[model samples]
Target: MQEFAKKPTAHRHPLPHGTLTLTTNASSMVMCAVLEQDTDDCCQLLAFFGKKLTSVEQKYSAFDRELLEVHRTIHHFHHMLEGRQFVMQRDHQPLVRSFAKTADAWSAQQQHHLSAIAEHSCTIKHLKVEPLPTSEEYRYLFTIINRSTRWPKAQPIWQQKAESCMKALIGWVSRHGVPYIITSSSWGVNFMSTLWNSLADNLGAKIIHTTAYSPEANGIIKRLHRSLKASLTARFQGGIWRKELPLVLLGLKTSPHTALNISPAEALYGQSLTLPADTFQHTMSPASPSDNRKAFERIMPAKATYHIARKVYIPNELQNAEYAFIWVDAHRIPPHSPDYLGS
Candidate 1:
């Protein structure tokens, strides 16, 4: 009798619900923005666009190329916004202004695209750009995680010149909604710190910081990086990595998420997504039974059961582990068999 009850519960675990996290890296920022919304929820991506030139001479030579890339990113964002709503978060503020400047600078065809985005009648909010800490040890990737979806996305913009990266971030947030919280590693430049102060004075959004070195507090973003790298490695062969970024990104967006037990597309759109024919082909017959359709529709698994199982399994799995910790809100816990404050 007990086994039968457990069986039913176990089979229904892993449904996609609750908070969503959006994680992004620089190479795949466009794809990240495309996946930032669901039926009733909002998904956001914070991105850093890299600048190619290292010196003033190179900047002049690469001017056209840099402008084109920036235009492309803006165009992509416009394309993703079709009939959807989203919030953008960023570590810098200038990118937002650049898009507006670029829009003003466009030729006819490009102007048309920019005009349409302007006509979309969307709202763009700019978070005040923050300065990084003076300490060199604390800089790492920046991330934006949605409070509701528990989806986190990150971009490593450290090597890129800070100003351009900040601009991209600002542009992204201006288009998307304001974020509830921004998480980052301690040290490096405290980019969000300045922004938070301004936001508190202006927008009234609270800026909270997590404990130092306790990235698990920012687990959603960390997990996204791990998953993205793993997915990229699995799908691409040696040369494919550099050549087929678009396809790899499409796969990431469409792939099933373990936490949500559904593809990111489904979580945001409230419907099954159609994959490109080149990437996926339908195997079912045209006259396949309705039962099969129902099976496909059931993307979300039972949440309560999954949470119970996760709680029971995670602690034992972490036993005797060194340097492991758990983060809840502002607090961090060292590895141990201990109950969470609220849970």
Candidate 2:
């Protein structure tokens, strides 16, 4: 087979002049891209990138794979191609639809891949590499949301290292007040790191670990994470998630909750946010603001009164009793037996 060059390698840095072009390809297993610039005589090489698809990625359709390949390439060369207009050369024609302004339904992953490199000024063209792909494809996500206000903050980290996590957490604390408690799952090395624990300790914050494989322990954060991702995926057409994050957060913070019947921002700050898209005037009423602190204090006496009247599990002596009765579910009980069983 004839080769482009036996030992020729692309320059690691930016080219001074000529048109910059990114050519990409992807198979089931692996994907590759070459960045080249049109010089006076020949197209001089700038850089190259390639990666093996993960098992999850390998299962994706051809269009998805090609789309992923394109996203990775733009992200890999984001620093060089960020501000300037450039050309993207790919084989799969299907991938171009993402760049087009259309109302067609896109997969969550597809929306995400497009959002990453959406900020860059680039144009996509057909190039036969065997096949094609979007943006700042973030590898790690650091998300924070207030338990009381339900206000959220999500940061995209390039690496899953502890330092990045620490930085993200510290930045959040600096902007918002230091949290009294920090809770997270055990999946991330960033969260499980010694540095993370130390940071929490130093900040006088208690670290709470969720039950392994159970999302319910931290369901609020998980739900917010899902919604945040969905909002970013749906509304954003281009640009890195970093830019989109604040916009999404704004909508989340200001949007009224169905249960509370008030916006989190209004609940916390006692006012509605002034936004570009807000058309109607919102009048705040002092009696109806869903401030949790005030509402809890106002309702505490009623809660105590109701519980006292019912006398349900009131001031139980279970701790002191040597042989206390335990409440068993119907499935755990005998074929025909009392609902409560001896422990």
Give the number of the best model, judged by TM-score. Answer: 2
Q: What are the per-residue Cα lDDT tens digits for candidate 1 across 174-201? A: 7555665555454435444564356444
Candidate 2 — which residues are off by over 4 angstroms? 1-138, 278-343
Task: Score each candidate by Cα lDDT.
Answer: 0.46, 0.74
Per-residue lDDT for 229-312 in model 2, tens only?
Answer: 689876666555566667888889889764346677776665668887565757656565457567554321111011112223
TM-score of each: 0.36, 0.44
lDDT for model 1, on a 0 to 1 scale? Answer: 0.46
Best by the lDDT measure? 2
Model 1 segments more than 4 A misplaced: 1-147, 150-165, 192-204, 234-245, 278-343
RMSD in angstroms between candidate 1 and the native structure over all alpha carbons: 24.4
Question: Candidate 1: lDDT of 267?
Answer: 59
